[model samples]
Target: MRVDVEYLEYLWPMRHYLITCGDFKGTANIIAVSFCMPVSKEPPMVACAIGKSAYSCGLIEQNGEFVVNVPPKELKRQIYYCGFHSGRFVNKFQESGLTAQTARSVKAPIIQECTAFLECQVTQAIDTGDKRLFIGTVLEAYADEDVHKGERIIEYAAGDFPRQVYGGRFA
Candidate 1:
């Protein structure tokens, strides 16, 4: 039997990534995002959706850059923490204990705990009702050599990783 799922549930089980915004010598934030995907290849581009009111959205708008950090299953708890808390009030980097290191292209920092990262400069921002779609041109991308060898790398993050199943989302 096929039961109806929520509109977004149809896209459930998407890989979650930690999106860091802001730059060195200033404020920054970590937000967990699952609505992320590759949208181009010529120059390499990615798209991620953020709530219009999210703190990350504002930062991206102000800075025009972001870093997408791929976390492993080991970071499930930190992922949940960043997803549920608002960066406006909480220092997710400090509270979640995720390190923010400099990115090669973007001013935004990448999460040190993550195994891979993509630095992108926002090329476009489109308003889509309650969510804003940010399309970014990849400026830099890297993967841990060990993880790149395909050794114990966990698969894309599961939807039930304490997300809605636990009761909250990034604000």
Candidate 2:
């Protein structure tokens, strides 16, 4: 019985991702997100909604680039830390101890501990009430061969495979 609530997550157990924003020389920030999804294939696009006032949001708006990082379950603690803390107060990388490394086609760095990453340059920005959704074309992507057994990251998001393998809230 779905009861009314002030705020509720429609997809509570959705796949979570780490978004790295801004250039190294500027204000770089990392935040955990669960609203990310693939939008297209021909031009290769993905979109994620970020809070309008978030540090990462401003960085992505100014820099027009970000990295979508896919972390293994081992980094769940760090992910929780990122989701709770603000990058405006603390350097998430330093505080969370998540290593940031250069990405191939974006100024934003990728998390070294993550199993995969997508380097993107924003092509569209849509205002959605309190949050802004940024759509980016996936410029470059990388996956750990040892972890994925050589499976391309894009393949996992292709059809019914993701639904079959992913989705479980931490209860």
Candidate 3:
């Protein structure tokens, strides 16, 4: 199959929320964008591409702590709102009507609305073209109690990506 380079570039839009704990204040802010979990379990890490001009990227670099809040498919509108706005200009939690709490290990805040949360400590940061690759190690993780025993957890994807329901194992 011949893939058109221009069309392929427009094929997918990645969507995710990057929450950080600020050093000066106790507030937690978020940036919504498309991110990837490049590695599965090797050292338990994930990567997020943040544009150089984004406000959240600066916070992540300055603090070296953040949380990846994976919201369920139901929060599609909230996700879109975060992805499109700047945290510097407005309080995302306030605008999105989301509540936040401090993370156990990292200074970053976690979105209580998410079905799952990943607390991360920045391990490395490298500039990749127009965006910076913010890589972090997962220090802690948790899932919502209500959805704990479900056969699958539904999550939304960016761009033309379809909603995904992933199964989980309980301990």
Candidate 4:
């Protein structure tokens, strides 16, 4: 039997987000994609893939700044809203009822609901077939007050991952 990549495309959308801001200044459009990873550690680098048609792509390319926000489990509803709907019509923040906070080094606002936030400045962008690969340097990073020593970062595996509470034990 032969396998076709196109046939498996429907199996998943790989639900993760690659948020970006700073194109239009006040109105920073954030993108939600499944591609995000740490590329380097010596200088602290991260990378995410953004489709060309994605609204945030233009903003990121033009301004070269963005905040990588990892939304917590509690914000699943908001994440769904932002991930599915286009920012062209409604203000995702207002629609989803998520608040925005400013980062330390960049002008882009960070999503306050996320457990962890990475303030990054774009270092390079590479063309990767269908999507643009954005490499950024981490300028600043911090976790929310709610996360404890035993708490694990919110993650979406298989389907909707359940939120795990931590008591005090360190991993």
Best by TM-score: 1
What 10-residue stretch in candidate 4 is worst by lDDT?
Answer: 162-171
What would the per-residue lDDT of candidate 1 be over residues 21-69, giving only the tens digit for each residue?
9875577899888889999998999999999889999999999999999
**Per-model C-alpha lDDT, please?**
0.85, 0.81, 0.72, 0.70
Which tens-of-lDDT digit does each residue in 65-164 have in candidate 2? 9999987766777877888888999999999999988888888888898888899999999999879999999999778886677544332211211232
Q: What are the root-mean-square deviations of the candidates from the true structure over C-alphas?
A: 3.4, 6.2, 8.0, 8.9
Give me candidate 4's TM-score against the actual structure: 0.78
**How do the predictions measure up, each by TM-score?**
0.89, 0.83, 0.80, 0.78
lDDT of 3 by residue, 48-165 (tens): 8788888888888888977888777677788778877888888888899888776788776787778788888889999998789888899998988657777665665454542331
State which candidate, 1 or 4, has the greater TM-score. Answer: 1
Candidate 4 lDDT score relative to the true structure: 0.70
The order by descending lDDT is: 1, 2, 3, 4
Better of 2 and 4 by lDDT: 2
Error of 3 at 19 (Å): 3.8
For this target, which candidate reaches the highest lDDT against the unseen true structure?
Answer: 1
Off by over 4 Å in 2: 5-10, 150-171
Model 3 TM-score? 0.80
Pick by lDDT: 2 or 3, better one? 2
